[model samples]
Target chain A: MTNQSSWFETAVADLVDPQDQRVWSIIVSLFGDMAQEPGAQISGGALTQIIEPMGIKPEAIRVALHRLRKDGWIESDRIGRVSRHVLSEFGRTQSAAVTPRIYARDSAPVEHWHLLIAEDGTGTQVLEDVMLSDDYIPIGRNIAMRAGAAPLQAEGLLALDISPQTAPKWIQDRLCPPELRASCRALLTAVQNAAKTHPEEWTPTPLQSATLRTLLVHRWRRVVLRQPDLPAAFYPPDWVGPACRNSIIRMLDLLPRPSAAILSGSG
Target chain B: MTNQSSWFETAVADLVDPQDQRVWSIIVSLFGDMAQEPGAQISGGALTQIIEPMGIKPEAIRVALHRLRKDGWIESDRIGRVSRHVLSEFGRTQSAAVTPRIYARDSAPVEHWHLLIAEDGTGTQVLEDVMLSDDYIPIGRNIAMRAGAAPLQAEGLLALDISPQTAPKWIQDRLCPPELRASCRALLTAVQNAAKTHPEEWTPTPLQSATLRTLLVHRWRRVVLRQPDLPAAFYPPDWVGPACRNSIIRMLDLLPRPSAAILSGSG
Candidate 1:
């Protein structure tokens, strides 16, 4: 029990945000990773127990829940003095949209890509509108690219099927900026250190498992969702995106998700 | 003999430039069409006979020849008081460079093409330097295209193997501008009218054939050399490039090239 407790504390410390932590965003990531299914709910006590290890106060969690509820991202019900929270339909839809990208394993590299070029001045708006989707990556003010063959019709734009042979440093840096690279490298180290501290003889309690999983998914969600999935040619030489993903997957496998009934039980 | 003389007079009148005639350019065209081969020379008398029918004066021809000599495009030699002119090595090289595009019949459409894109501001010069070659067509300030696979190396530029599927009006207009389209349309009309005047009963003298071939090649060279040979999609709907090429080819077939020896002989 002492070994498990020490390991859990060390893992939580390694994963917590050293910068300003947005409690509302952490809650969204927690629910998205844990209780995303229909009719699944987390009691207010369980939410606090899972999040308090990350150094968030109970009042902060309450305020964030209020904000999330007002913003239509969460809903709550009170039954016999016990409050329970569930993801709203709007929240589930938004989470579902990004869930695949956030949790996706190393997928096959996208084989085909096409470019959309707008006219220099006035046509930029047309391409800008199309770039609102996550699929499009802006190469320049008037140029955007997407994976797959060119559409049969791209109005007011010049569409070309492109096989990107090489890219310059500016392009690689633009796709994976300095801040993103730093975050990915930091997370990789954190996950690697946490994995090494796990003692094989000790298994975590349901609440402990839930707490570790929340921290792992919360930090990783921020990193993985900020960058697009591009071919290896587009990444800088020192980019650790693949290594970061491997460490993250390995850590998540070690900390299996705990069921909601056991997590909410009053021990 | 009377019928042939009348037909030659009408042909010269139909082919003379209504706009300002660049005499030096016309001389270049004349040599490129009739005496581009090594050791081939046109006597002074033959030059006068072939060019005078186009309404240029002998004094104007002499001045143009002097300018061409100063420009290193022509060399003059006097053998037993008979002056002769031949293309210099520099002039022949320049003429041979564009000869294929000037005289090409309907060729197979280029199936492969690539685009070179420069970074927005500073990289434009790199693409501009590449655009100096006739093979590249500048699509925009930062974009140039060529009809072949991408080079193995393009320093400081993004190289993409592109299959251009659809282009907007601005791209088409940039490739084949209004003036080029108008010139092609006008040449098409002229060639169609000239082809109708062929009389089966009459055969032209060598001087007549050389004069007609020079005028045809001169006008067509001014039109064809100014535009790159792009795929049909790059041209506007009103572009007469294919029709103009066909008409010019039919006219050239009707007027066979005269040998330099026969052309220089005094009738």
Candidate 2:
């Protein structure tokens, strides 16, 4: 049963070794006094109450119980609807010498990379969108070129929405900096600023820039990947040949921009 | 071999399953192709070359190769320095459709978190030290009256760095909120602002505001947790008591400023 789950969920399973160890430490620290009772069904609520002394994630107790059960060290059974978990003999043996150290995922904290948990508890943030900047463009183009695909084909591969025909004009005019005309990337700024104000509506502003088209094209990729493809009507009217958009994407990927830094503009 | 490597490295192993199916897609697709050529030695350069065509991590390639080997779908022989990984008949028979899809972890692009990675990738960010606010006295005094910790023990816990003999004045002056006293948390602002500017030299600018010591004594619980012992000098000269300080920390957590807005601040 465990192997099957591990096969499907390799990550959580893999973490069973380390994350499990930490989970066990917390569990044992709470129940050390109750160590002799083999089959005692400790209420999950009681587990949270135990950790009330420490300030951390509210759901960490539930997660600890779940991981414990997965590792065969604990067995949880429900009485009425209240879930109760108990340590197995193996768990008792394992928890003998653990010093209950806090296992935050940071090996060491660095100045540039902060591990932030939202104080608002909504853990949502902006790292969600895959950027379409000068830096990312060259990478998109080159990967496609290496895959023996032209610019448009590359865009499809990179999951960018832009077509090959219009891709070059977009890249040349906006994406690759130093060569970019300030007016070309104006649409991107407009889109980003607009996103801040209206969190839901995705349509571009009246500028009708490549960034807007790029988002639409990406949306189509999602549509294609999730819901099967639409018939050829998905193709544009008088669609030109050889994926013209790809050439532009290829040129963009050919750039040497560092992946992390933005090409221009401040937050 | 792949499983062994994965057991050691979570990021590499994570490239396998639901971390984002796109990662798995890349892994399986590239491995499937490479597995066909059993005699070819898969070098890091070759793997790098292949992934360059796709724009993913080298670790991802190693992980996929390991997974294939672990599942007995592939057999690998290491001769001198090169690893020759060959797919078994079962691998050929599995009719898996390898499409490009993002995995759970990689599903989100990582541009948003205000993570402070070292600029030179060396100096790490460690919290110099953490202490509760200046208003330790009044807060503890209030808790003292309520059904809180024992008066003696509570007093000790709140003492933090302050002495028991001088606790009351600190709490009354520095620790309590405006409704409790005449002042809001202005002293907190000054101390915190200084810490933010130079964490190494974190000293409260207003060290001698007559009531501050009383505030410190009262809020001792903020500086310390419940097990309170210490015969006296556990606190430094600037050591605010536990109760008031911990409360101040709690208050600070409430100010949820979103990481300087999604740092395209690479201007």
Candidate 3:
């Protein structure tokens, strides 16, 4: 048990974001990963047990919860002497929107792609409006592309059905910038190290499982959601996106999600 | 014979360029249409006979010949006290390059087209360089397209093999601007009028055939060469490009090319 505890500490340390760690954002990630269902709620004690061990203070978690409640991302209720929190309706909608991308294991390469080109000065606003959807990626200031045929509402732009033939270094670099590549590589290494350093015959308690799942999903969400699912040709030579995705999926499968009842009870 | 002469005079007046009449450009058209072969020459008398009837003075023809000779478009030789002019080597090469486009009766619509997109700021120069070729049409400052698969030397741009599915009004307008559409319509009307006004039993002399052929080819060249052979969808609604091409072809068939020997001898 002591060995397993030590491994769990090490894994928590490995997954905590080294950059700016806003407690509210972390709480959002936690709720999005664990309690995203309509009525699913996490007790205040279970949230602390899952988050406080990541070097975050209990007071910081309380403040983040207050902020989330005020912003309508979370709702809190008191059951006698204990408190429980659940995602608000708006929050659940937002979480459900990106859940597919976060949990996608393997996406087939998109074959049919189209380009939307706007006129230089006046048509930029139309392209910008279209690019607000996640389906499109901006190729240039006036050009946006998507992995489908042209839409029927393409009134003010020139839309063409395109098959990508050759992607140059500039575009590859633009799509998968160096920082994204580095983030993917770092997450890949972190997950691999976490997997490798596990103690033999180790089993995590319900709280420990919830903690690891939240951390892994949080860090992986930050990486996966930052990039669109471009074809392999658009990725730079050193981009490890696919490998990182595989490692993340492997790690998530290893740490199956714990029920909210078990997590709150253990705490 | 007098009636034929009056008809010929009226035809010449109708065919004269309402815009600038640079005699050098007209001569280029004449040589390109009638005497493009190596060692084929037009005697100075024949040139005068073809050009002087268009209200241009003999001295203006002399000055234009001097300019053509200085610009390396025509080389002159003294043949038994009569001057003869043939296309210079450089001029013949330049004229030969555009002959296929000018004389093409019908071009099979290009099915395969590709786009080359450049990075926003710095890659504009690369796209501009590629746009210097006649094969490409500029869609924007950073985008150029051609009617084929991606080339082997696509160094600095993103190349896409595109099947154009829709072209908006702006693109159609850009490809066939208002001025070009007006020119096409005007030439179509002119040719139809010329074809309508021909009297019965009109057999043009060799010199008259050369003159009428020169006028028709020259006028059509100005219109056809200004626009690339884009797909039919790219042309504006009122663009008469195909109809104008058919009229020009029909007129040329009616006025068969006269032999150089007969033309010069008639002069």
Model 2 lDDT at residue B151: 23
- Clash pairs (backbone) in predicted model 1: none
Can you tell me the DockQ of model 3?
0.76
Span of 10 residues, lowest total lDDT, candidate 2 chain A: A258-267
Candidate 1 per-residue C-alpha lDDT over A1-267 given as tens digits, one digit per residue, 9 for 90 to 100: 587799899989998877758999999988898889987788898998888989999999999999999999999988887888999999999989899987878855564789888888888888988888547888777888888888877887888887676777767777888888888899888988888888887688777888888887888888888876776667788888788888887878877787878544433
- Residue B111 of model 3 has an lDDT of 59
What does candidate 2 score on TM? 0.15
Per-residue lDDT of A222 in model 3: 85
Off by over 4 Å in 1: A133-135, A263-267, B132-135, B265-267
Worst 10 residues of 3 chain A by lDDT: A258-267
Q: How would you encode candidate 2's per-residue C-alpha lDDT over A1-267 as one tens digit per residue?
A: 543222222321221222123444456544433332555545665555434333325477677677777887877777675666767777766544331211111112111111111111111121112233311222111111111112322211211111121122222222233312222233233333333343232232211222222222222222222211111222233332113223323322322221111111110
Tens-digit per-residue lDDT, B105-154, candidate 3: 99655657888899999899888887876468888889888887877558
Kindly report which residue pairs in candidate 3 clash with one another.
none
Candidate 2's residue-wise lDDT over B155-227, tens digit each? Answer: 1121111112222223223333233221113334433442333323222212111112212221222222221
With candidate 3 superimposed using the best TM-score fit, by how many Å does residue A16's alpha carbon deviate from the native?
1.4
**Share of reference contacts kept by candidate 1:** 0.64
lDDT (tens digit, per residue) of candidate 1 on B111-177: 5788888878878887888777646877766778888888877777777887666678888888888
Lowest-scoring 10 consecutive residues by lDDT in candidate 2 chain B? Answer: B112-121
